[model samples]
Structure formats: structure tokens, C-alpha cells
Target: MAETIVVDPITRIEGHLRIEAVLDNGVIRQASSSGTMVRGIEIILRGRDPRDAWAFAQRICGVCTLVHGIASVRSVEDALHYPIPANAQLIRNLMIAAQFVHDHVMHFYHLHALDWVDVVSALRADPQKTSELAQSLSSYPQSSPGYFKDVQAKLSRFVASGQLGIFANGYWGNPLYKLPPEANLMAVAHYLDALAWQREVVRLHTVFGGKNPHPNFVVGGTPSAISVGPSSQASNSGTALNMNGLAIVQDVIRKMQAFVEQVYLPDTLAIAGYYKDWFKKGEGVGNFLTYGEFPSEGKSIDDLSSLMIPRGIIVDRDLTKVQEVDLRAPEQIQEFVSHSWYDYSTGKNAGLHPFQGQTNLHYTGPKPPYEHLDSEQSYSWLKSPRWKNKVMEVGPLARVLMMYATGNKPARELVGMALSKLDLPTEALFSTMGRTAARTLESKLIVDEMQAWYDQLMANIRAGELETFNEALWEPSSWPAEATGVGFTEAPRGALAHWIVIKNGVIDNYQAVVPSTWNAGPRDTLGQDGPYEAALRGTELADPKQPLEILRTIHSFDPCLACAVHVTDPNGEELLQINVT
Candidate 1:
């Protein structure tokens, strides 16, 4: 007999998640991943000033807010045909890299590590040994035994200080998770260390953005004034020689690069040895996709000479031969709301781009929709995005594959080194484990690249390359009567696309195809699973009550449901409703 098992209120990650599994005795049958809460962000965005959308959109996810801000501005810039300054491009890339470091460190240590390591186990760790480990890994004076003792002392104080907010609802003593006491202690110490490191690195965003989490960024150009003298405002005209703050910014970048190399990278490798089993599981959706990122050079999409991050698509696990990515190319990309509550405008097919979307409501049973792609038939608010109408992977794994396929020397070298060190086959880089490992490896490369960009900025500054324009002189009356534009950017998750239509200087209509929408959408009208869905199929569930493997695999993608990212509590007590038979 088959019975349903549910693990609700999944912990230690962003937002909430519910995992429902079907089991026959000890064997698994099927699984359903659910996001149980809803807050209408789209409804909130409607009728608001198009200019203010960035402010609200950034708040959609506390983790990757700056990414959303950039995506939003890129959309508006597309509509306005605005050209950003070269220096602005470099600054944005640097900010993005800082966020990458901040996010990855936080995710690995605080969020994901908690699932693998026991915080309480840290109390028994030998502080002197940990300091020795740190020092042996790097020649830094800060990694001495005394340093780890202070770190342990701080952790104790943190728990006693009523500031265990980050550890609320944590399950450190759970028998289901297997973690060595020593490893646990090290992770706990690093957790505090990372929190401090992330805060310092995140300031890069504040330098350019004026703040972190959500900063004021304009589409055409930055809302900043540069000054060469005592004030940066004078440099707004692009001719000022304000090298004061820029030097400080570059120095910080150098420091961060050192930390990622000497600290975070080593930590990841050391921890990987403890959980070598992960190398065998969590591989999903081999095909990867990336919309070229970091546009600075005058290069076209096909010619990435000018862009800091190149845009392209990869398939068949081949990243070498990239094809031009055109949203209007064909009907390859489609959306299915059948399983969802949304009323499908088309009964027979997935919604096509530009005109395709969902916003209707239907109350089906509480169970997930396994048949139709319509939201009315589905359980998730996220719409499934498909490439060539098939689920394709997107994330660091995909990005790295695409980069390597394009012969990115730095990424290739790092990936090769990681694979070799892990004692895994090089071919394994194309699997689920590859995707997770790729994220960490790519981060190391980006850390170095950020420093490279900093050096480039120094060269340009010395060579008299400066920003001459600050404010955009706008005449509302002279604004176009009607216009349409497409904005594409490489978000931290993957490629994000937004299309906007404006009339009389006001947004007539707006639509966004978020990264999670692509990674976690319901089936399209054709009954095709999105990337996450396809990856979920065939995954083993040893215990229905606690399917840690599946959760790790899914969360490995780092999904952020921009529309609604909440997961609800199952409340333990089951409610039974009787009906007349």
C-alpha cells in the first residue's frame, strides 16, 4: 500500500519549503515540492512609477536584491536605449562580484552547512587545533590558535546574548544528519567568521549602489556624481580626477580576493572530503544556459569584446559551441500554468513569450498538480520555463560549463583543479555534483577577475578615461509617445529577461521572466517539466519524513521565487475531513 509522507517547514534555507513524498513501505514512489505562502509582489508593483519598480523589485529577495535591481534597471534602459558609462560598467561588475562572494560565503557556512554540521558539537572542539588548521592552511597571523579561541568565545556570547536569530528553529542534534564533531566545530567558527567577512565585502555594493540589499541604480547611468578634489561630485562630468575613494575601493577588492583564496576556497575543499558522497548525488539537468553578463566593451552579443560577462546558450553538456541567444528566435521558450491556479488563455499550448503570462486563480485539491501545466491544476506559483520546450539547467554549473565550452581558461583551470582534488572523474563535472562544485569554483575565478577589473579601472583613470556625464536632462513633454524595449541581464541565478512598453513617458505594460520562474516553473502546456521538476524525477528518497538528499539537490540550484518565495509549516497534526460515501 502506498502512503503519503510530508516534511513541512524545511529549515536552514531562505524562505519556507514543504516536501511531500509517496512511499510503499521503505521504498519511495513520488515527491512533490511545495511553496506554501503567497504575497502579491506583482500586484504590489502594478500602477507604481516605472522608475520606482527597481526599489520594490530589489526587496523581492533579501539575498540577491542587487541582482533584481540591476535586472529592473536593464529593462528600463532597454526601453530608453540608454548607454551606460564604461566606468559604471566596471563598477557594477565589481559590486556584483562582491555580492557573489557575500552570498556564496553566507550560503555555504550559515545556511547549508547547518544542515550538515552540528553547531553544538563545536563546544567540544579543540580551539588550539582549529587555530593550527587555519594557520597551516594559510600563513595569515589572524588564523592563530588564539584567534579561534576568541571565535569560540564569541559564539558562546552570541548564543547567550539573545542574538541567535540566525540559528532559530535549528536542529543541530538531529540523528538523521551525519557530521563529525571536529568538522562541526570548525564550521561553527567559520560561520561567525564568514558573517563578519561578508559584511565587509558587501560594502563594495554600497560604494556604487549607495547601499546594500537595495541601492539606487538608474538605467541609463548611475545616479552618482564624481569629484577629483575633496568631493566626488566634481568628477560627475567624467573629467575630474577623484582617485581618493577609488583607491580605497581597489584596496578592499584586493583584500577580499586574498580572503576567498586563502580562506573560503580551502574551507570548501576541506569540507568536501567529509561529505564525499555528495559527489555522487544531486546532479540534475546537464544542459546549462547563460545570458552574457558585464557589458563594458563595444562588442556585440556575438562579439563579447566589450562586455565584462559574455552572453550565450549551451546544450548537450557542451559549452564550447555557443549559439546566439535571441528571445524572438523561435517558439522554443514557453510557459505552462495548467497545474497552477492561473487560468490558461490557451487550452492546448504553453504561452509564448511577449504575450504569454498567467494571473488567474483556481482552487484545486491541496495536492500538487501532476497532470496539467495550468496553475489551476498545479501547486506552485512559479511558472515553468523551457528551452526548446524542454527543462534546461541554469546556475553556476551551467555558467561554468558555458564558460569552459567557450574556453574560459581561468574557469577551466579552477574546475579541473577542483575535480582532481575531489578524486572524482573529470566527466563528473557535467553532473549534479559538478553544478554545485562549479558554483564555488566560479566564485574563486570571479574574485580574481574583480581584481583584474579594478586594475583596469586604475589604468583608465591614469590614462585620462573619465566619466563626463552625470545627470540625464529629461524633458517629459518631449518624451516619446510610445516605445518598447527588452532588457536582458545575467542575474546571480542565471539569465533574466524583462520586457517593457511605455507610452507618454509612463509604463504602459511590463513583464519579467525571472530566473526561478525558469528553474522552478510548473509544467508547460505540453506537460514538460521545468528544470527543477526534471531534476527531481528519479531522485531516491530513503525516508519520506526527511528527504535531505532531494532538498539538498533542489536547494543546490539556489532557487529564488521572485513572485512568491515562501514555504508553509505542515503543523504536524493532520486534519481529516469526512465526506459521504
Candidate 2:
């Protein structure tokens, strides 16, 4: 008989997720991914002003807050045929790039690093050796022996106090952890450093958007104004993004670039060197997709001609040919809820495009705190998103592979350098470890490009082209009676697209196909597993009781279930409740 293992509320991720795996002789025979909450945010969007969608959508996930806002406003703009000024585009690029750097670093150090680093092991590490290891990795000035000793003492005190806090409930001392003591110490110290660094980097978002988390976004342009004069509205009011504020933004960008180069990149490579075997495992679906983001000059929202990140599909693990993604075609993208806790008006078995998508709850799994999920029944709240009805992996790996396959110069050079350092081939870029490293490389790529964007914006402003907002299509009278458009961008997690249908200036229907939805959705109507389930299949477990190996693969995609799904109950009553031992 095959045994079932359950990992509910996978700790440290943004939101709740339950993974059920069937093990046959210590190997995963099958896996199921479930989002235990319902995301009715789309329902909340109905009948609202199309321009206000960004505010509500941005609440989808606090961790990836700004991404939804960006996509939401872009959707409205696309629908209205509105075009923002060039400076607005560059500012948006800077904001999105800042998010990638901030979010990826946090995911690596705070969320995913613990999966590989044993906190207890760091206690046994010598502070001097830890400093030496850190110094060898990068020129990040915090690699002193005293710094490591201080971090170790803090860890020691936390352990002695018996309150591990965030460090609690981890699978410590698990045989699966491969990092040596010194490496563990170095990672832990940088983990703390990242906490401080993130605070400074997020100031970039505040300068542009007026605040962090859900930043303000207008359909035509950003809410920020350019101010060069002392009596300018922004200068007098001391609002962010003023002339003085622009200097601060430049400083933040410099800090972001420094940290990515010094700490994030080196740390990822150093730690990954210990678990190189992981480069061969956790390959899923063998299909990658990216909607393509970071537009350069001459790139329109609907076209991929000048996108810094190319948009295409690589299927069956073949990187030789890239397929073009057509979001407007009815048959191109569809969502299936066959294994999900929802019903479609047409039928549960039918696949619906975003313009015609529906969300109706119909939970049909074992009650909460149940021992195991019935894999044959509805299991998740996430709808399986398919491109041409094929399971696809997205996120950093997809972007990296797309750039590599297209012979992108910078991507090729960076990937080549990293692979040569690890003594691995291009094939190694297909696994779990590769996904994590790709995220690091992506941060560098985005940050390096930030300088050019900033320079362009400054030049445009100096040349008397300070326009940011485009009011040509701001009036409701300017739009057609009925219009539909899709806003697509590459979020930090992966490909994200939001579809909106507007009638009489009100949102008729809205559907967001988030990155996590692509990666963590349940099995589709055709019985094909999603990326999460596909990656879990055939994974070997060193200890069934402590499934660290399972987490390594799942977290590599940086699962954000909150962005994938969300919820509450009616009439002040809990739908289902259970106590687990």
C-alpha cells in the first residue's frame, strides 16, 4: 500500500498551501497541490470603475503588492488605448526592477535559505571560519569575525531562551541539509543583513509610488510628478519623486545594485555549490512560458518586438524553437477547474478564457485537519492555467531559459560565467537549484539595466519632455461602449496577466492569471498535473517524517498561495473547522 504524507500550511511562504504526496517505497508516486482558500477578489471587482481596479487588485498579496497594481492599471490603459509618456514607462520599469531585487533577496534569504541551512548547525561553526567563508564569497563589508560572532551570539541567545520565533518548527539537523557549519553561519548572518538591506531598498518604491506595499498607480501614468523648480508643486509640498527625491532614488538604486552584486549573487552561488546534485533534480513539465516584460524603446504593450525579456514558449524541454504567445486568441490561454474547488457555468470540465471566466465555489474535499486529500476529487482553489492546454513552468527559470535560447548577449554571458564556475552544462539550468540561481541572475540583469533607464528619464526631462500622465484617454467619453484588453507583465514570481472587460466605464469582468496560479494550480481537466505536482513526482525522501526534500523543490518556485487564491465566510460563520494533532 502506498503511504500518504501531508504538509499543510507550508510554513514561511506568503500564504497557506497544503501538499499531499503518495509515497511508494520512499519515492513520490504522485502529488497534489491545494490552495485552501477562495480568492473572491475578482468578484469584488465586478461593476467597479475600471480605473480603480489597481487599488483592489493590489491587495491580492501583500508580499507581491505592487505587481498587481502595475498590471491592473496597465489593463485599464490597454482597454482605453491610453499611452503613458516615456518618462512614465521608465519610472515604471525602475519600480518593477526594484521589486524584483527586493522580493527575490527576501525569498532567498528569509524564506528559502532555511530549507537548506540548518540553524542549529551554525551554532557549532567557528566565527573566524565563518568570516573567512563570507570574505571569500564577496566583498560585502560585513564579513568580519566580530560580525559573525555577534550573529552567533544572537542565535545562541535565541536558542537558550527556548523561543526560536521564525526559526521555530524548522526541520533542523535533518540529514538532507548539506551545508557545512561555516556556510550555515555565513548564510544566517547575511539573512539578518538582508532584513536591514530590504528596508533601504523599499524606499525606492516609496519615492515613486508614494508608499510601499500597494503603491499608487494611475491608468495613464504614475502618480508621481517631476519637479525641477524650487516652487514646483512637488518641491513645495516635499512629496516623493521631487528633484531632491530623485537624488534619493538614485542612491537607492546604487544600494540595490551593490547588494545584488556583493551579497545576493555570491551567496546564492556559494550555497548552491554545496548541493550541486540538486541541479539534476526537480525538473517539471519541461515547458516554460513568459509573457515578456521590461519594455525598451519602440516596444508596445501588445507586441514583444523590443521586450528586454522575450515572450515565447519552450515545450517538451526543447530550447531549439520558441513559440509565440498570442493572448488575444480565444484558444491560446484557458483556465480549468476540474480538480479545483469551483464550478464553471458551462461545466466543470470546460476550459474558459479570462474574458469569459467564472468563479463559483464548490468545495469537495475532506474536512479541514483531515489526514489526506482524495486526489480524485476537487482539491485546490487555484484554477489550472494552461497555454495551448499544456502545463508550463514560469518565473525566473523561464525568463533565463528564454533569454539563453534566444542568444541574448548579457544573459548568455552571465549564464555562461555561472555555469563555468559551477562546472555544469546548460542542461543543469533545468533543475531546482537552477531556478534559485536564475532569480539571482535576473536581479543583476534588471539592476544593471536600471542605470540606462534612469539616464534616459533624466535626459528626457532635461530636454523639456517632463510629461508623465497621458490625459488623452482619461475621460470615459473617449472609450468605446464595450472594450476588452489584457495587461501582461513578468512579475517577480513569473508571468502575470490580467484581463478586463469594461462596459460604460465600469468593469464588467476581471480575471487575473497570476504567476503562482500557473505554477501551483491543481490538475487540469485533461488530468495533467501542474508544475508543483509534476515536480514532486518521483522525488526521493530521505526521511518521510521530515520532508525537507519536498520543500526544497516547491519553495524553489517561491510559492505565493495568497496571490494564487484568497477568502472569508458569510453570515459570520466558519465554513469548516477542525483541530489537528
TM-score against native, each model:
0.85, 0.97
Candidate 2: lDDT of 116? 90
1-581 in candidate 1: lDDT tens per residue?
77766555455555555555566665444555555444344445555556676777677777776877777776766666566666667666777777776677776776666656667666667887877776666654466667677767776776788765666555556664565665566667677777777767766666666676786677555664455455545545552325655766776787677777877787777767666776766555566667767644322222355554556677666555776566645475555555554445555245656434444343333543233122335566555666666676677777777777777788778888887888877567755455566767877877887777777766766677666233452344544677666666766677776666667776665666667677766566676655665666566666555566666677677766543332221343322222222
Model 1: worst 10 consecutive residues (lDDT sum): 572-581
Residue-level lDDT for 271 in candidate 1: 69
Worst lDDT 10-window in candidate 2: 566-575
Give the per-residue lDDT of model 2 (tens digit) for 5-113: 9898787788788999999999999999988765678989999999889999999989986999888998888887888888888899889989998999999999999
lDDT of candidates 1 onward, in order = 0.63, 0.88
Candidate 1's displacement at residue 487, Å, is 1.7
Best by lDDT: 2
RMSD of each: 5.5, 1.8
Q: After aligning candidate 2 to the native by TM-score, how far in Å is the CA of 3 from where it should be?
A: 0.4
Error of 2 at 284 (Å): 1.0
